[model samples]
Target: MLSFESAGRGILCNDAETRPSIWCKGVQPALPLWLASHPDCTPYDPASADEARAILRSALQALYVDHQAGFYYLATHDDTCVDTGPLHRADAQGAIKGMYRLRFTPEVSTVSTASTNGNRKTPPQIRLCGAGKALQRVLHAARLLSQDWGIAAEVWSCPSYTRLAREGRAAARWNMLHPQSRPRRPHIARCLGDSTAPVIAVTGYAQHIAEQIAPFAPGRFVALGATPQRGTAYADFPGAPWITLIALKALVDEGALSAQTLEAALRTYALT
Candidate 1:
């Protein structure tokens, strides 16, 4: 399980001497996949940021079992905004090992600047201004209530989350008391909250962080996110619900992550 205990100083190995909270959470699955695919590349191909984000979306569908209620939909980060020029290092298993991975041939491409649908078809979603602030708000809230629930959590992975304490001056409180000063940066894995029960369940690589959940701690429920792709072979999670909240809605709304046919697909993925 990924614990925040070792997260005090930094999660990423390449952090500056000053040390920052690695906030390793926001990283998409493609990061590890790139590391695993190439052994000879010095810096590793860094162009698949989109593929990683897309993979995470798929993983969320496979991992989070909504029961009757809808699971949370998240992130949907703008692909064009991510700077894939940089590299991160990873161990043999694809776990990020150092600050930099060798560069590699990118399989993902940039979004075309060409014209397309230009409108808002869905309800306006809400998120923190800065990823750090969101992390600070969510984690600080979790920590303050820790003893009450015996649920322990710490900053596991992210530079955005680290900046909250170091730069955002976030307090150990929920959004009610410590309202943010800025908007959250775009990324799906902002922060996670959990209790002694499966208050929040995750899928895919995210499930790896299941170490932070209930039966281990306490809370009514918690936050969650995931990483996925189309096929079940290269994607899908262990015990998550078949259909996802995103895909379900996508059907009627003509959105991408609709839930219409997802239930069947989910059933298939689970059976497989």
Candidate 2:
């Protein structure tokens, strides 16, 4: 097992003549693909300190108990300060087995019913998936969605988008080859099989990082990231406000919310 940690606080030592400089960027967008390019390499990124500890324990099990012969790459960042509580204790035992799966955050309700808007019928709920520091923003956005728009939002912590995409591709190939056999469902499909709600996946890296799972995501899927859109200023990451706006736009497109509601959100966020 090969483990690596990056502060995601891009820093460099220029020379003896100059002070150490900061690059102010993270490699998350490219690191996944770089690691995936190698044979037998499995990449995992934890959103919080507890998740990291759980992943470390799982890695040890994979190495010793399972006698796994492949390369395990555990990539972590030091830029964010996450709670070290036992939030993931219940899921630790199955961490290794479901390394590629998305876990529901504590904020998500176990209830299946969607919240209605005023006297109108309930609108379609939306799912938000994010990893690393971006997960924090997604959680905040989830709260705002319910509080401000009466939109039911579920938050999921995705530890490995690369793993999910890889498994999804493998399932596609297998199903193509065995047309008469029961089709194998990918991790993404199994995780989101029941919900037809729109999925808005956010990442601190480039948009492409989250777009990786778009093809496999059920129903409507939107990917958000650090990259700036045309005519918009560049940002290192997308925050809760931006995420909320995007969700409103998706709701408008689905006819769950009126165009006026989306326009009001855009104005509130100063996105227009």
Score each candidate by Cα lDDT.
0.27, 0.65
Give one digit per residue, the lDDT tens place, for model 2 in 209-247.
678888887778999877544563334667798999888
Off by over 4 Å in 2: 1-21, 24-30, 79-90, 93-120, 228-235
* Candidate 1 error regions (>4 Å): 1-83, 87-169, 172-262, 267-272
- Candidate 1 clash figure, as a count: 55
> What TM-score would every model get versus the actual structure?
0.21, 0.76
| Residue 272 lDDT in candidate 2 | 76
For candidate 1, the 10 contiguous residues with the lowest summed lDDT are 124-133
